[model samples]
Target: MDPVLDDHMHLDPVNGRGVEACEEFADHGGTHLLVLNKPSWHYGVEVEEGGDFQTAYDHTVDVVRESNEVLAGRAWPVLGVHPALISQLVDRGYAPEEARDLMRAGLDTAAEYVADGRALALKSGRPHYEVDEAVWEASNEVMRHAFALGADLGCAVQLHTEDGEDFTEVAEWAEAAGIRREHVVKHYSTGGVVGPTPSVLADREELVRAAERGIPFMMETDFIDDPDRPGAVLGPKTVPRRTRWLREEGYDGALERAHVETPRMVYGIDTRATLE
Candidate 1:
């Protein structure tokens, strides 16, 4: 009974039930969750608002503090200056490098939070396929800085990228940026873990796929906290429920790898607690 961990979940107000969601997860045997806060949730400001470097930085820190309070130490925040936020700056007359430097400054602040142990992970990277090449390149540049920052802070970095991007390529990019492959985890990634790197997946099938490939990965509900689309990604209870289901499905070995081994070895979550 190793402590069950949800590699990803969101508990923001836009989902409109942050505290209740936390309680539901804990009640369902979720010992720890990788919590992410939306920019709009923390600051009244969105990228469209064009907040300056300090404004964005402080907002990220505020989200960290607020999320930690909500979890009461059961979770930590993953902060980053998402490419979409930088796209806003680009629209406002920032050159690619300028936009990236501003995001770099945001990661600097995020790195400090990890150093203080107010947080455990950093989220940074390029956006989806529809982005302009220039914006995407700029975003990668900023993330290079971010990867190095996480490496220095001893934090795992979760990448937000296209759904089926190749792991070897992403791992190469992280290494080129001085981020160890083991330190880089992908968000919303398919269960095709090709290397020693870990990825977050959505369901038992994905987990089974990765296991069949002899790949390592972690599972996530990616539960967007949108009340309108409640359980849009998956419910807060999904991870623990899925873990139990996998155990019953005779995939206990894969479940143990994903729920315990990979999370500890790849993401480096605290594993001092053993399931009795």
Candidate 2:
């Protein structure tokens, strides 16, 4: 059987259902997941300095560790500064350059976790929402810093970006930073990226459309796991359930590539081994 994996999901033990969501995914046949840290603000960590991000990052690592200890399958952690932190810092009277420095420093801390094998990948990106040109440029700088760190750590980088991003310019940044294009993934992506691999959301028609493009890609639910808005951006069970739906629709080959081959290439994780 092809191992089912969710490329992006969150577990907020404090504010949400937490590991119970993992149980839901597992119950529905998920074999593996990449658990990411929520933004620092969500954890009530006022980012005065880069070291402040350690609290949120540590929480995420602990959550993944606990989830792995309980789950029969596996969970890998992804940690980094959320790109929207730029606006938060500026709103609190930070200069764009200062915000950029803080975010880069935060990613440096995240890279430390990756280097120590406490996390599997680093997550960073520019704001998906619009901002001033200076903030946008600063956000890109922070994102490029992530790519550079990924090159040094030899781990994949997951990006949260605006919809319809072609990623042509991002490909240049990856190359200049010495990280492979495929090593950068667009999380919550609906395809159409030219450079970074697309971690496509688990929608049948969208999956079919992405798979038909003949580029490497993977599937994700981007499950937020918030109690206030349960099942937002799809649910915990969406990936495995969608995998079953695709298999039923005779897309077995595509499923194998998405669930197994593509993840191994991009994340260096073999879901087959995790399943075993």
Candidate 3:
């Protein structure tokens, strides 16, 4: 088997012992592993300990930095707010005004991290934040800001959308807002608030439709082995099969062209690195 590129995985130096896991993954046939910066609370940070928020951010940074060293340049880091954390950013620490300010600063910090080449993608989820119509609109507003920053920074936007909503809404908005097709990618995880099964039948239809329209798309397993985690439903060993299925389903050709051919044309990445 050729080395598989796992595009979306979260590595926490503070928990799940990601450094060791990453080394093991590389030793066992993984070629590239993309890590996303997640909230400290996800790793069990106590709310009372000032949460060591800076330490959490630094921890995520260090993991990516070290992973790059270990992999000899195969690690790709993605930094952005998880949609669930968006409300927390504004509703948690300060007066409503102050909270909004802090949230903006936090996003700026994320941008700076990306500017340093620590992030290859900006990760966000729509289903996590869209609890109501107002929240849905607000979620788009937030995504607009994030997308703008991501575009300026030369990073891709990885979006998580509900299965049924017209994701073309996203593509259309991006086009209207001047975001290029190459800069936006959608992650179709297998299960969760938004996954393959839960995805509206219509959404799946739209994905096929979008492909016909020449939109860039990708499928990700988003699998985690921890039994307590929601993603564990899609076991690790199931990843390859899922990839094969997506390929059989037609999303493969486009994704391969983007990750393999197009990147080579633009960045001079050796296509041999993607050989299977």
Candidate 4:
């Protein structure tokens, strides 16, 4: 079987299924995961400054560590400030400019983790919903900073943004920051419309369309792992199960691209090696 990798997912040991979720994935034949940190608020950390995000980042590292201990590097961490944090900070009484600065600082801290080799990628993006022009610009600025950091570290940066974004502006930012366009990935993306690279949602139709269109893409579950919303985006087994479906349906070429080729190209990790 091709090595099945879910490119984006979260594990909440505190309020969610945690490492058990990873076991479920493994049991279902998932060979690897790009485990991202949940929001700071999810960890109950009130971020007044950049350093405040350290606690949340640390927790994320710990969770990823535990996951690796269980599955021997089955999970890799992607740390960064969640983009909606702009609104959250605003609601918490921070000015728009202040929130942007704090988010940049947070990404700086995440970059520190990447620098230390605790994480394999960085995450950042603008709000998916509507927001004020100032807020939008601030979010874009923060994401640009992430791109710059990824460029410096030679790591991939996963973006969480509103649907239907072509990422042309984002591509320009990545270029200016000196990161490859392929490294700027749209997490939870549905199709080739996202950008040069997309960590596409693991919907069969979308996956088939992405393959048929010949877009460079990866697959993700976006599995929240929150018990309250059980199987909200998708279950932990989705990617592996989908991989099996693809094989059974004889999409041999698409299977290789989604599971092995794209992951090695984007994140620079050999999924097949992880299983060895």
Candidate 2 ranges with C-alpha deviation above 4 Å: none
Worst 10-residue lDDT window, candidate 4: 65-74
Of 3 and 4, the candidate ahead on TM-score is 4
lDDT scores for all predictions?
A: 0.68, 0.88, 0.52, 0.86
| Top model number, lDDT | 2
For candidate 3, the 10 contiguous residues with the lowest summed lDDT are 193-202
- Cα RMSD to native, each candidate? 3.4, 1.1, 5.9, 1.3
lDDT of 1 by residue, 1-276 (tens): 455677777666432676677677767766667776565424455343223333544433454355445442356567666657776777789887777777787777777767887667888878776778788888878877877887677778887766664668767777776767877888776777553265556577776677666566778888877777888688988878877877787877776777668778766765435232
As for candidate 1, its clashing pairs are 1-275, 13-16, 15-225, 15-226
Q: Which runs of model 1 end up more than 4 angstroms from their true locations?
A: 13-15, 40-42, 46-73, 272-276
The clash count for each model shown is: 4, 0, 3, 0
Better of 1 and 3 by lDDT: 1
Model 2, residue 171: C-alpha shift (Å): 1.5
lDDT of 2 by residue, 1-276 (tens): 558889999988778887889888888888788999999888788988779999888878877877886565699999998888999899999999999999999999999999999999999998989899999999999999999999999999999888885887897898799999989999988755677899999988888877777678899998887888899989998998889988898887888888889999998987887775
Candidate 4 regions off by >4 Å? Answer: none
lDDT (10s digit) by residue, model 4, range 171-221: 878988999888888998886655548888989998888888776788899
Model 2 vs. true fold: TM:
0.97
TM-score comparison, 1 vs 2, better candidate = 2
